[model samples]
Target: MTHNPCLSDMSKRVHRFPLFSITALLHINSTSALMLGRGLTQVTHIKLLLFFQTRHTG
Candidate 1:
């Protein structure tokens, strides 16, 4: 079987930065972090949402 661990980790990292930022801003942990099973765009989009809600909430 081909190993995709590296890719997975890379995905996590890429997902981590923005995700973490959004998480921090939104005050949410990784519980709501979207992975879409494994898609970069989805992950980024989710992170963006997290960021948006985080900053917009008065």
Candidate 2:
């Protein structure tokens, strides 16, 4: 009819660990995706600038 306090605490920790890991993974994925998007935009801008410069020079 009773449970040990230490066991209860350990069970809570075991449950919380997976939730923290999942959120950490999601945060890392979103951060990387944002950086990738910025990189692509920068590459596209640079290419457009190069194309316009070459057209003007020619």
The candidate that achieves the highest TM-score relative to the unseen native structure: 2
Best by lDDT: 2
TM-score of each: 0.34, 0.70
Tens digit of per-residue lDDT, candidate 2, span 1-58: 8879999999998887888788899999999999999999999999999999999999
Kindly list the per-residue Cα lDDT of model 1 for residues 1-58, writing each as its tens digit.
Answer: 8989999999888866876576686754343455443577878889999999999995
Give each model's whole-structure lDDT: 0.75, 0.95
Error of 2 at 40 (Å): 0.1
What would the TM-score be for candidate 2 when compared with the true structure?
A: 0.70
